[model samples]
Target: MGVERYNDLFITEKQKIFISDFNNNVKYFPDNVHFTLAGEISSDPGNLGSGGGWHRDSPYTNQFKTIIYLTDVGENNGPFQYIRGSHKKSGYKLINKVLKEYDYGENRFSDDEILSIVNNIDGFKISTITGKAGDLILVNTRGLHRGAPLTEGTRKAVTTYSFRNKIPNKFYKT
Candidate 1:
């Protein structure tokens, strides 16, 4: 879906509250927003049908995202998964080092790479977010996250992307 449809779906008071919370928590104004409908019946379980693999939304920048579930999400229905606390400096540095070694482009990480990064992090936890319609999750997209494979039903969700605007530094003569 597009921005208009996303705005329409996000009109309710609860949605407003959630969005407000996201803005406050992330301390940034959202510049871009979008929606997506997934998990239609398909014979082939390709990238489109199965959704994306494990990866960060923005690898270099600190971006914040809020996902609002429009339908019930279960473990078999392509739930959202995240590596907890992976947004911290240490976590990002560790992952960045591994990514550099692999020379991977700005794309999803392979299963082997995911495993290696997770193994390097101390006390890393994987959290699978399964919730009902209207459930909202705010995340630092710099961390490792992905949409799990859908084995049964579909998932409808809207995501808001917020980034910190860069201001040029002005130099002055002494």
Candidate 2:
């Protein structure tokens, strides 16, 4: 198959359009990634807050990612969770607080630290997205988000990481 055909197999029209528009006219490369089988990450997926904890992809830059669920995802199967309005709310207050505790490259946050900031902002609700296989999820990775810890069963997903400018590759454990 041709290169465009290969991309067509994974990049939906909406995904292409959104990524292009979301990052303005900047260039982007879509990476179709399949990973994390059952028992691949950890025998106990919910191993404390070590793996699937709350974080922002690039706390100081714009980041976009699209995910497709390859398996049924319930609360216990590691649903994707987002702190609504986090992409735009809290402003420097959030960044300042996080930077003081963590460097820009390491942007993971503890539950108490994240909650303490968002709680002050009105309309910032936590949205846990649980869906069936083949569901498409678009996320602003610069916002505070995470995959809920799995307690039973397994969760598998394919992700497309989009970037405006070329940068070093980074991957987060599911």
Candidate 3:
């Protein structure tokens, strides 16, 4: 089922256009990619599911992700939220330090910890993205972001993860 969805996304014209546009603007190719379909309908508001807590996809590497909403997302539903401009080196360092200190073994930051970190960062802005089906969001997952908890209704989406090794290889151009 997952593979089928991924293949569908790969062949879709809309997705192709998105990827092409993204590739044109970014330095690295969106290679080593994988996708997942999240159909979350959590009744517990506090439960930070796999992608629900404030966390980075990788601690020390650069990675990107594209999230396409399959269902209409509202504030009450699980909207994709991000701390704007948090992908910079300083922001990354700050977040990494906080996560290391509060490392709970799960690689996810608690709400209090996330809030505290946000408070410490000057001019930090949290953006809640609510969109209709087919809306696409490109994000650097090395920043502070999360899937906001759902108060009601289901939130379905497909997220593609693309990662590249930071170390330069002598044989291949990164």
Q: TM-scores of the models, in the given order?
A: 0.74, 0.67, 0.75
**What are the per-residue Cα lDDT tens digits for candidate 3 across 141-167?**
767789887777777777765545332
- lDDT (Cα, tens digit) per residue for candidate 2, span 1-174: 112334454545765566446445433334322222121222284454213688887777656666667678887777889886676645545555644655545578888876776666556667999998778787777788888777877777656555544434443322
Q: Rank the candidates by TM-score, best first.
A: 3, 1, 2
lDDT of 2 at 9: 48
Candidate 2, residue 144: Cα displacement in angstroms equals: 0.1
What value of lDDT does candidate 1 attain over all alpha carbons?
0.66
lDDT string, candidate 1, 28-64, tens digits: 4544433333223322355432336787766666677
lDDT, candidate 3, at 72: 95
Per-residue lDDT value at 47 in model 1: 40
Q: Which stretches of candidate 3 lie over 4 Å from their true place?
A: 1-12, 23-25, 30-46, 96-106, 165-174
